[model samples]
Target chain A: MSTKRDKVIVCRCEDVTLHQVDEAIARGHRDLESLKRYTGFGTGFCQGKQCVALCARLLVERGGDPPTKPITPRPPIRPIALADLARLVDDGDGP
Target chain B: MTEELTQPFDAIPDACDVLVVGAGIMGLATAYNLARMGAGRIVIVDRSYLCSGASGRNGGGVRAQFSSETNIELMKRSLELCDDFATEMGINVWLRRDGYLFLARNAKRRAELEASVALQRSHGLPTRMIGPSEILSIVPEIDVSGIEAGSYNPDDAVVFPWPFVWGYARACQRLGVTVHPFVDAELEATGGAMSGALLRSQRVESLGQEKHIRAPLVILATGAWSPEVAAPLGLELPNHPHRHEICSTEPLKPFLGPLVADLESGLYFSQSMRGEIVGGVSNARVPPGVDQRSSLRFLGLYAKALTRTMPILGSVRVLRQWAGCYDLTPDGSPIIGRVDSLEGLILLCGFMGHGFMIAPIIGLLTARYLLKNEERELFHRWSLGRFERGELLPESMILG
Candidate 1:
């Protein structure tokens, strides 16, 4: 059997451990965004792609209400290169 | 004891001496400066939580190696402020000054690096041009075959971004500045002069109760949302949001010492304090907007680019991928100063991607400019009217 210190990472993007999520909840981070900000859970490169659902489940399992709403997702749902966007620059001469 | 000032709209005063529009680093730092300067009745409102914008999502690289005299000078002061930001803000920001190494793949880019190093050295920055062998010596893991030349500055650094934002928020609250998160504020213009903003709760229950807050001075520090915020007031800022994505790999024993950048591919990465390799590469086809979604294309591109530069990272597992908006400007320079079109409105947006690094100094300079009427050279060079005057100052050292 795995010991309690054996870290089970819930958010792979941020390397957030399940223990850390419990600690965040203990510290009163009830909502998804609050938990995210407190524990650096869903703010990684994947931007919570795999961790949001896991966090929601953890919240429910811990007797907390499911997050009132999923954390607000921002743009480019996937990582895009800056050079790719720079190539779309019109340089002001488009008719 | 610092009172909890992050209250809802109903608990806030209807008017203040200054109303800061965004809660990102720029807005928060500027409000902290204003409060420290004893500006009375200051209130800062954000549509999202603290550090939810570009300020929170950046790669946390701070460098003074720039191709322009203006940028180098500004970054020099900014670097000094960042060097002591932890002590100043009363928080450990995990600042690491290992250095930043920028590589060039072609002769044209090498020449650009050389010129930029010269300009940077002229401004007292210790940046210098180096060959591939020197680059290899600094970061032995990188593939030096294709690298023609490089520029490196030992003074450049990186910091954990979340603590920086939290530090500023805490300092602002301690200084008696009110910060309201989840509050939607819109600029209100009356008779071509500046007025106040209409505030409403972003929460579902109090959605309809709009509160009007009056202030003589309104500063727009909304990074990607700057244009949207100014559009209703008839101000057309040329700044647009370009999405940039970054990824982090699983922690490994630290080998990389400095943030490395490919000048051509716009790929930059640095090892974090916790041994995670964090960085991003620029894509050529992303559309302009605030879309911050991560993509598989970025992963493939980053994997290829990173391994090509440093082949050993190919086996590293990428743990997370995320995206943020860069408030791109037409001239590739930031717009900072009072707007001539709006009477009491000051413009402080269009930082491209380096807003986090420059926020500390900008906050100080902007406070001086607004409170003491200090005319700074940065304000003149990066004025909003420069774009209209056909005078553009484009910096060549921008990397993602």
Candidate 2:
């Protein structure tokens, strides 16, 4: 069921469909980063929290070797509130 | 023959006339321009895929409302290029020229905006200072209670970021410029001159395999990673990386038009063509480095700032949040032009966070300088030696 194209949303945040992932792979983007760039999968709001593993599996299934190196995840792993960021300034820890 | 062509490492040439490092927008644009000008044997190498750097990660805000003369001039040219990019490059970048609305909450900030608007008007940019009511007319959803004044430029635009990179890459490919992804390049310099680069394939698990690409001219467009790439060759660059985080809310019915930015809080956001509210706020606490980690603190701050400026955004669900590094210099302007200390090595990094907006003009200018020895006054103003000479051209209107 998970392998079904329309049923699976690889990146829920971006609403990237499984068919889109397959198409990206078919176009020679067999790696996580290239797939993310081409299909807008892992770069959404969650920043790959729900999609990286699914993308890796698709890459392997499409005759590509498993990614030996992990795709480097960009920061703010979890969503935080705006008030919390302003408090950093009050605490004198602002960037 | 087809198998050899498909092989990753085999596609990389042993030597080229010009070797460009970094496959981001800057590198690709420069390569594309060089190829168009009949520059021979150009090769572009990236440690990661194209647009993986700040090019792919920015909020895609392009504006001519700058505080400095040089930036305003450069961005004017860049805006024209972006306007014609779709027709010229055969790619629809989705250039939406709804305008940019910059808000000021206090007297001092309002004064700065007024001065900037005046300068912009003098330079023929259709930028003007507007009142609180005018701001509301532009963005009816904005809560302008604390806003003292504002500036608006209807010519400023928001573009789809990924296709801009892809369009340049495609054009480069058409011009016979070879681009190698997942290849790490180490500068091979001798006596303050670059001779070649030692390339390592990052795709396979080859323990000791390395390829050397000998070239006389090398352009460093590595963005945030510029310092680390230069350090191996004993070159010290003053540029540092500052992480800026952005979040996108779920798509909604389009209510906002202009990309609204609060001058005091460093919060800026715009709705994409597909309707996602994409924007971020700057934090003063993010330490300088290549750390692209997003913080819950940023999310919280962005939420508060967004709600404070535009209360309508409070109900939108933030679908995702991410971060990218801004190649920051002490003066806030970029480091461009040839490095006097390093012969055959050109520098094109340190754009703060506005590299994407200015890259089109820089690419053309850098290519012209390289191919025909055409030097512009802007290049001289942004040279690397300006730091040591203490002749800083600080830009006042920098936002995330």
Candidate 3:
């Protein structure tokens, strides 16, 4: 009984489905922050770059919360290796 | 216009028994326990959404490895509560009490840990001081070159900060306690006593959005912003805010068994249940004030510290970085309970960096003290009058 919406993966990083996001919306956990926490859509490796807009659209169109401010974007928009960041400076060579 | 808002304040009359300010864990947890004791008409108001304060922005480290007896005792009870948090709060906080390894860099630090472990053991904590080999056995990937020694306890824990806040907010709601976020409250005092607060919506201010409420008792649970909230009401608090930054890496197979901290550098990191390495470093270079902005210097400093501690993590990918203020006191100890200068108000702040960990026991004890009309000497010991009496409790093991 899997439909197209269920099959359509909204968040590639967390593997959140479009239907899953809609269900979280209907359960009163709307808004981008709560929706992100409830559905696990924005906390993955991609950090919501690909899925936040689609989830926001679903929230507003599906009788959830109105469109307010966008979710807060965290730093390191793209993943940075710890080794690369360590060499960010030669602060020292010891612990 | 404020009535259009979805807050359930209309169900609450203008007058109530207790009003808790700041919907963070301290306030939410205290209000939850009070409501469970059948204290009627409890309402909690927050200037922003839940988890927007220090409660939402902490490393979630819970440990009983303090140099002092009282702190160690309080945290021991909190760890017990954390063990039952998932079942009791109906929210999974992912608490793992695997252990906490405090690595000492120099002999002085080693001596400090040695003394702290001795005190912790005397007080029923199974903490022990270990050499470099045992340290290596614990974290196998750690670079123990500069490490002299360590003190470890198997019962220390870390948790996800968000669910701890959410769990208490949910528990309060199930007890008929209303929590309204995004509501800014301006506290009013009459004749040198806390009268109540004037509430307004932060999202939709102006346009006749003000509402006046009355309460006999109020709990000032605002952490870093306590000074700002208390200033207009004519109370000068000694606590100030120090911004701290923390970051997490992408998920991987969980290898680290416990949280590891370098005592000299103030660097602490623990692997989450989702496998991301969450950690932060104490940098004195961060300019003072209520700044939550992250900096490149912090990233560089933290990376250097992490790579120096564990060279193998150099290849790990960092996912995100965020910051929150630490509510600090002059003597490095938390000030709890009632203040002498402020009538009809109880103090629940100045927890410094470790408030998030010890809130469960404090909340329970606060309700027990208020509900049963009993007096705890611990509250009197931590009163604000001690600062004037020069009885400063200088705890030495405070870190990020």
Candidate 4:
């Protein structure tokens, strides 16, 4: 919990830093969902794969959670083109 | 962080003055206001965590631009309350009053908008009808090629929806009201009145064991899940939970002036505080449920509609897409106040897609009604009994 590690980037997809995550936690966003939202961590290009665990661990470090529960995972876990996804559904193919 | 916020939740009480079901914005707002007015021993229980329902899953658009007088007046007050929310609740909701620009793609829709704008203007709302050329100046980000006319209101705004739930719940908790999350409630009616509910924990330690709690008054803020609570009681509250979906693109330069909506397709988009172009389109083709999953159908519809309206956003990559339920009553308006025969059970639901927008004023008014028995005409007009009497003032300005 040193200030030296404060600026370390946790969510590369959104460029959310560890300091930002800790700050959100300190401001009463104890749950992973609110933390994910307030810090914009797990909602970036990686869709939480890169930063969810880090943020969850940080929540535990701040004495919060059943840390296993992360934010809700949505479709197309990897980034996909909007045109391509539209085409995929139009062609009768979907997840 | 304060000591009270991170502190562990207190145990559920066996009895309370008011039992509020669903800890979403409506319930929390109502509960917080009631507790503030010295309504004793308020307890709120939800099946999921905060922001887990329609309250959290909305576009957070608060506007007074509506065709009806009641809708316009309620939203006008809701906007002011939102302006003072941060100071009063001690949480920054990140409210941005960039305004809402509604576009009409054809002559028919343009005429409809013109009439609505006139109605809005008569109520002292600053809504103005504009041409496509003026629409370009409002939001150059949108391509106004097919747009015939537009409705521009500078007061309509957007906010980060999560903080409203958290702020209200925290305020309630600080006022000695226990706002329990991850807990389920089964409505219990005895003799005639509601006798509170049977609570069961949904967490790992204590799960599915019901505990009886007694209270004379119970409020159902259950939103789309009200049918389940109503069915066993033999009360016919007809509605369906339409799953509405939304998506956000990667952050870009913040250029969009207002939340833009296509009056024809019900397609709407706005730039978030973080600069992501977040948007959604109207879709009711799917089945109704609280746990409706996201579908490729939503992405397809939204992408086509959004791209067709704003060609510049065709290549913008979608970072996330999710779905939530819109609690649609038989009539478009919300069903508030009391239900007949169900003496102690009150209904504060069916606000449709604009519940989050109007919840603040409704919550304040609902709390006043409970405290002093003050009768709001909206409570009577928006009651479930109207459906039986054929007195439906169905609202027309609903969006996804």
Q: For this target, which candidate reaches the highest DockQ against the unseen true structure?
A: 3
How much is B252 displaced in model 1, in angstroms?
A: 1.0
Poorest lDDT segment (10 consecutive residues) of candidate 4 chain B: B1-10
Give the DockQ (2 decimals) of all models: 0.12, 0.30, 0.47, 0.42
1 versus 4: better lDDT goes to: 1
Instruction: Give the alpha carbon lDDT tens digit for every residue of B1-400 in model 3.
Output: 1111124334435877899999999998899899999888888988876777888779889999998888999999999999999999877898998899999999899999999999999989999999989988899999989889999998899998888887888788778788876677788888878889988765432323678889878888999989898888888999999999999999989899889998677889999998999999887877777888877767777888989999999999899898999999999888888767768888888997999999998899899888886557888778877899898887778776
Task: Candidate 2: list runs displaced more than 4 Å.
Answer: A1-19, A42-54, A69-95, B1-7, B205-208
**Which candidate do you rate higher for lDDT, 3 or 4?**
3
Native-referenced DockQ of model 1: 0.12
Q: TM-scores across all candidates? A: 0.87, 0.91, 0.94, 0.93
Q: Could you give candidate 4's per-residue lDDT for residues A1-95 as a string of tens digits? A: 66766769888877888788777777566678768767778777778887788788888888656555668897667666666655644433221
TM-score comparison, 1 vs 2, better candidate = 2
Question: Each candidate's iRMS in angstroms?
Answer: 8.4, 4.9, 5.0, 3.9
For model 2, what share of native contacts is present? 0.26
The runs of at least 3 residues in candidate 3 whose Cα sits more than 4 Å from the true structure, single-residue gaps closed, are: A1-8, A26-28, A63-67, A92-95, B1-12, B204-208
TM-score between candidate 1 and the true structure: 0.87
Better of 2 and 3 by TM-score: 3
Off by over 4 Å in 4: A15-31, A60-63, A67-70, A83-95, B1-10
